[model samples]
Target chain A: MADHAAHALEPNPTARAFCLTSAFWFAVATTAGLWAAGYLIAPDFMANIAYLQFGRLRPIHVNLVLFGFVTPGLLAAAFYYVPRLTRTELFSQRLGVLTAWLWNLTVTVGIVSLSLGFSQGREYAELVWPVDMLVVLVFALVGVNLIMTVHRRREPVLYVSIWYVFAAVVLTALTYALGNVIWRPDTGALLGIPDAILLWFYGHNIFGLLLTPLSLGVAYYVIPIVTRNPLYSHTLSLLGFWSLLVVYTHIGTHHLLQVPVPTWLKVVAIVDSIAMVIPVMAFLINIWYTARGKLGEIHADIAGKFIFTGTIWYFFVSIQGSVMALPQVQRITHFNNWTVGHAHIGVLGFAGMIALGGMYFILPKLSGKPLYSRFLADLQYWLVLIGITGFLVILTTVGLIQGNAWFNGETVYRVLPEIHLYYVLRLSAGLAILSGAYIGLYNMVRTLFFNPGVQA
Target chain B: MIQRMTPTAVILGAVAILSAVVFVVIIWPNTTVDMTPSEIFRERTAEEAAGRKLYIANGCVYCHSQSIRAFDWGHGATRIAQAGDYVQDEPILLGSARTGVDLSQEGGEHPDDWHMAHFINPRWTRPNSIMPPFEHLGMENLRLLTRYIQSLGMQAADKRMQRQAFWKQASTKAYEAGIEANVRWLSETVPQGWRDIPTPYAASDYSLARGRMIYQGFCIGCHGPVGDGMGDAQPHIYPPPLNFTILKGRGISGGLIYYQVMNGITGTAMPYFKKELESQKIWDVGNFIAAYFIDELDANGPPRGIDAAYEP
Candidate 1:
């Protein structure tokens, strides 16, 4: 425990900048989430308003949450941890700061363009071609920095986190280009059934490759240190890492189970989606074991607490994701609020929470001062936790109602009344998350700039 | 000093326990849902069987679910799917998404010609369907695909197909009787009360905006950028697309338009948007058509003094 505490006290300006930038985007993403939630509840609330309509705002919210909030927060941690794990200073602090600025600029462009209805109309890959290219470029730059750091490492043993961070960045760069079909500037799609298959393969991978691995990497790093214990088994962590790469890479086809792709492809997807249990459980075991009987320690550190809770959500989401992949279950879950709920859970509840934890854990270490407001940080945590949980319950119930009604041969109008309240509840929860984002932004800014003459 | 499970061991054990619980609680039952597709689909003629193969091959089942449950009636559901419906179906084709509407009871919904046009390019018939064109399938295979899609609901589909066959015979006769008779026949399908009522809402800018919004969200997907009813989803709809201009100077009533939009023209890809859009949106869209394409305004008389916010 003392050694872990000692390790956390070192100051690094690169880490400070990363944390500050992450906080800014987190605030933006949650605000978009709240706006979209409000639109869902009262379609008329901002109807006819150009920037706030559900058609435009939903994509903005989704993209912002993915790129603006969660991605940046995770990368901020990676920027700090990757170098430390390798026992090497970052290859270029100036380049790292430049990447953060460019990344924020790209996300800002995406949010504005999407709000103005300039989307390409694909879920998750909604960014226009220019922004998509920018994202790829950003990934390439991050890759160069991280890989170079690895090359210059003082330590010989490359940890599992290093593997995941590199895989996520490189795979995302390749898949984003392919899935966006960036070459076809006109429709951004293939001609027929091939298009649908290609699109969802990219769509599902956004969750599988980008968010999933990044969140797991952060979890692996945070849990052991907080518990003041050695990793139970490096072997298990490595096994889990490789299995995730194999299983998650191919399971994107699960999204096409209902489409007219090859039956053989569907078979592979279903099998692998089920087999996701192997990697998912392996990682969970490794992390939870690292924190065994250390609940007290985790609770005392706000970052550990958030990261631990995120693991619990990963359990719910991956399990639910596996079931939803089944054709039978998908019969009721697809094209309704059910999948939407899963999207929020996986994106906001799982990845979003972990990113915040990473930011919190690194903040004081980089700044050489305690957090500006522990009370406010804790408040933000509770608010987001409640908000996301509420969203899950409300959206799931609405999805089930819509699914069952559609299956029963009832008219769509007859089911609207039943699900109306759930939408309203989701909107209320979004408000909580939105406020939390603002609170986090304020606390982070204060910690970065306001020089209080006290050190804990 | 306290001794507890090492971090690594604890994480591994937690993983094992959770995995076992997931396998037991979720996966086991999913695998056991009596999903032997072959067992359910045993009794079919060679043609229906052929049609089934096409359904599977084209991925028609991907966008359409053959199963109708008790709670589905709110979406203008016709019949609840039964286990008996699947008695002769092998590898039951209960699809996962509703990109296109459900087809459990699609057997006799439309005439063969409508299906032909729809299979060729759904937008020709339904202006808002996202269903892709099957023109590459050529005329014969298109007909075969139509047969399969029409037969999705089994016995119920058979009943509906019978009605379509009956109507086709009469409608063809009426058409052969020339323009006057055909127009009369179309108008006669409407009840007397609907024939007389003009639109309740007057033509206004707000109405046009509301109409435009609904058009973009629902109609524009199928109907083209203009009101020619040539939307992108048209390629998969049948009976060819409705040329809204065809309704021009035809004395189409607001009530008639409302009814068709609300209930959808049965056996066509023009889905009832009653669930997705509210009553006001339908009325506004109808008015947009009347004013812009048809150059007719039935709401020319004194304005109804109803509350301004009334949706229907």
Candidate 2:
């Protein structure tokens, strides 16, 4: 029973499969995003084409990113690391592999269904009922497999990363079920505002419980390892974890602040949203402390560079979110490109960066070889960083102009011509991300199947 | 504490957190949400429901907002949105953006003919709108979309449609009764002050030129380049567009022209320009119509006041 035994030595077939799945869908999701950006610049760019309409393509891009690119990318690492952390073989590689196949099919079916005009029309719960069922089934499968591995663990102390992995899977399963309202199975909604409440409850947590925790988990595992420093404090880690659960869950109603939702609920949401600083600062302080003065070492590992940048984005996104939740700030930011800018930073900038980092981190280990092309991976990192930052700046400018004009007596048409150039700039920015996605896909595919590098 | 937990306890804790949020956020809202429909709300007709689905499937909600807030300004301030208005809706389409105009009160704002042309291309009605064309939906789907748009204000929409129907019959009958009778009816429908009041500004070359441009932008689709009432919209409009030649020598006053253009004749293809045009532009276009089509000279004569300046 040596400490080095905590590290996995065998190839993880399920993880490799998920890595491939994530690479393929990253290409697809970004392509959909590019079309959405193009449609904004010229509403008639792909006009009259039913499946390619901005409305349809937008949901496609969003759902695919959540389930396709980011989720699988994170899961690719989780499937590899969870077993190693537990000091047990995966509960069942066959089941995990089956789940991967099913996950890919679910995403494909979701795209085909949305393209064919089948949608429940809720923002995050856009999947049709049958598709929704499939999503639940897959989440359940993955959760059960991971939990069983935990059940058989040889490791006595559950690392914080393992706690995070469990939280993401089990929490997301419940959130997806409740948010999508699978009980009704017909309309998949409660009546009126309650449905909105339920939807955003699920919606915000999809990022909070799922992406945020998973990305953080990957960072907690990879950052200290890359820096060759132990975690700063287990006490601080637990504080951050519990506080995140307490604060993040109740802030969904910040979206409904301007609407006529209950004042108390809005107050609670706003208070908790702003109060998110506790967990955010706790997590950042822990990670930054662990990696203090180790910039050179963190940058040396391509994966560590990505995860470290993700922590920085987490700081920016968290602060922006807390501030934006204020009623006054929301008046200007809500329902505008400012929020869009925020989402791009949160998803593509923070969660997406970590997911990509985790994938790159695990790819070499799973494939039993060095990364085939570090240059390509580093190129993608820069491309995504520049692309997402560009989105934030351009979209924020456009949003302020539009929001201010709307506050005045100006008509929507008056602001359209003003924001046209920003839309074009956003499209150009999207090209960088789109190119990055394809490049990473090529790198991952080669690393997984065709690497010419030396064995690990 | 999180590190000390076994996997089972950790999952239980996650469930506890999730259940807590669900209780406060979802269950609380559920028990408290008012289920009553708003005064203006009613159940959707089958066609309207179908149209709503079309609206959703096509992603029209992405650009158009169904809810107007207290500080929305412009048309968004026309009605403060009530939660009750959406009780009967399966999925509320209270959209997030106004990439186009707010459609919360969009019902009956324009005639079906206008929506049809605008759907084919928004530039047909508004020269600067950024709305994507829905021509790909084909006419059947477009009509369904029109029904949903017209039903946005629910019962309020029905009342507007009633007024439109009432005036439509009268307008069509007047048009069919011959030009002399048509001009008489058009003049009489205007308020007495408007029918008798001449344009306050003298018509000039600049005024006429501005009027022509305004007409081309707004009225050309239905009124035609020559004002013969055989515009491209003729086939879609019932009773056809008014033949301006009919107003000639029939005592068609500038006041009558201005009034008709300002408020529009409901039920006909003509739409109100009150929101879209200013007072000066309406008078200018009226003068242009009088000088060119009717050979009238009310503006050049008296019953006028100080002339409005060019910039003013």
Candidate 3:
């Protein structure tokens, strides 16, 4: 396999460890996703169980997908590439392993606590105060590790990937703190409208800043290497990076467009939401340009294939998100399943796919072996692809029905029958993602420990 | 050698095609549905116009849709909104979210007083509303905004407003006429048979528990935790949250409670929950109010009806 030749070329123990940890989390998260999906389909299927309630399981699915599956997967790649790009060894393999262990422990704690109904009752900020602080600590540790490595770099040119990873870590640490409202232990709220505004601002930014930058960083790293090309425009790449920060920061008010916040704030949110096209397009143009004339290369590599697909989803989701932010468009989309659809698509489809790609790309190199089963990995990929696509279609349709019916003055009860089928459909689609997770875990476990090959 | 299109060229081509299509398909044509202009909607007073601007500014359109269609009749359908109703609008305010009730034909749905308490805090009037307070709009602007909300249905709203005005006068007279007359006036509105009909559910513990859950979910936001009609929205609703205690020993019936809940009292913020809650839920909540707050429970005793499935 090509992995033997690649392994012979570079023997990096630290990179391999990163890959192993990322793969393990990927498997764990996918399993949780499947369980959550099952709960949705038959709420009573797992009846008499406190831990399996749809409300509890839904957050578990989301948090695991975000923190356990996607974040670690991307960071594993970052661990490999930062050293490679700097032409130096990782700053501390020991710290990297510690961060990994801490991350997994936090996720486990989060799942168990949430299922036990110890939630703080905030959407996306569901983790109780202790877990929230741990997440912050993890971010700080990651930031220190990555920054220290950058400081000790042999290469002078700070790559765009490095910039993205740094920004994602730093910005998330700050935003998570504000969004969680850690200062207010009791209610995690200020009083009234201000609290709602602050909460959503944090809520939207979790996607815009944390998930978005991290995913984009992986895309930037993997796309160029697979295509055997340098980036098309460093200027445009930076343009995208900065513009994303500028535009995405203020647009959180878009979530509150229906609220009684000051009118000027709404205007700002609307304008910026529309203006999101600039940064979004800028990133797309830069990446697509970098991979110009390399369609075969992209198709040939599994990682490239997933990353490219993620970019496509990002295109759709960001556009959809911007439009949904508009007051007129939000009229139908908000307070319905449309935003939830957006959430799933943005988190799972865009960010989640890229994370998977990053993990896959690093796995063979780290394990010093070819994938235990390329067929399984490919199968998992297809399943996830099909699952998220199904999610988008089903959830968007459900959102429209709810929106239109409410607009038409039909009472809420009248619309329940219309949307129950879609909920069932979402549950089914979630199963596909869940299956993919298990396949991924099996592949990783076999490659890491059970592969019947001697290390070079 | 491989034949290939440059990524730059592909992206540019796609963008160009997309832009053209969007222009042709989405942007060129009218985006908003047309609305009609009724005499009452003809011109907003300056204060009402300012209030309209405030509504637009606060993103009120996000939660409250201003248009109603024929299909909407299921929720105690007021008149369906007409395109001509929105002819004067620049950026029509047909809102999207439903955190609050729809306001398409809101005029005269409540007296002006009902709106004031509602805008201040939705729970004060109805109880379980998630609508954020507009207290920042202050007492003066809140009133103006109330005027604007009341004018949503134009002619239809005017008719409702007229009713509210008449009721306001009568209610004031009754209140001043002392508790006996006030309670008498309240019960006099109900038909005689409705006054005596006992609740059918027997107000069992299970039934009351279900009712309490329903009440908490649907009513506590506006009806006050204690059913004093002092829910969060009370400040915004007028003649104020219906003080259920007033009905004590006044012979209020199960049918009357059911009817009021199904079809909310217009000109107030007691929105009809028929669309939001199921029949069982409404009945449960009605019983909860009867048993807990009002200390009245007519829902008891043996089955009085001839069962269709059972042989006599």
Winning model by TM-score: 2
Error of 1 at B273 (Å): 10
The lDDT values for all models are 0.71, 0.84, 0.70
Alpha carbon deviation, residue A262, candidate 2 (Å): 1.7
Q: Over the stretch B119-214, how does candidate 3's per-residue lDDT look in tens digits?
A: 665545544344455555578888878888877776667777888777677766775687788668766766776666666666767778989877
Give the C-alpha miss distance for residue A2 in model 2, angstroms.
12
The positional error of residue A92 in candidate 2, measured at the CA in angstroms, is 1.8
TM-score ranking from best candidate downward = 2, 1, 3
lDDT of 1 by residue, B1-312 (tens): 011322233334334433453343224433433333322233456677666655543445545666554545566666665444554443445544453577777677666666776666554554434455556556767777777776766655667677666655665666568656755766677687777777888778899888886666556655666777676545554433455666767778887777767766544445556766677888898888777766777863433446467443
List candidate 1 segments past 4 Å from native: A6-11, A451-453, B1-312
Residue A161, model 1: Cα distance from true site in angstroms: 1.2
DockQ of 1: 0.07
Q: Is candidate 2 or candidate 3 better by TM-score?
A: 2
TM-score of chain B of each: 0.70, 0.86, 0.77
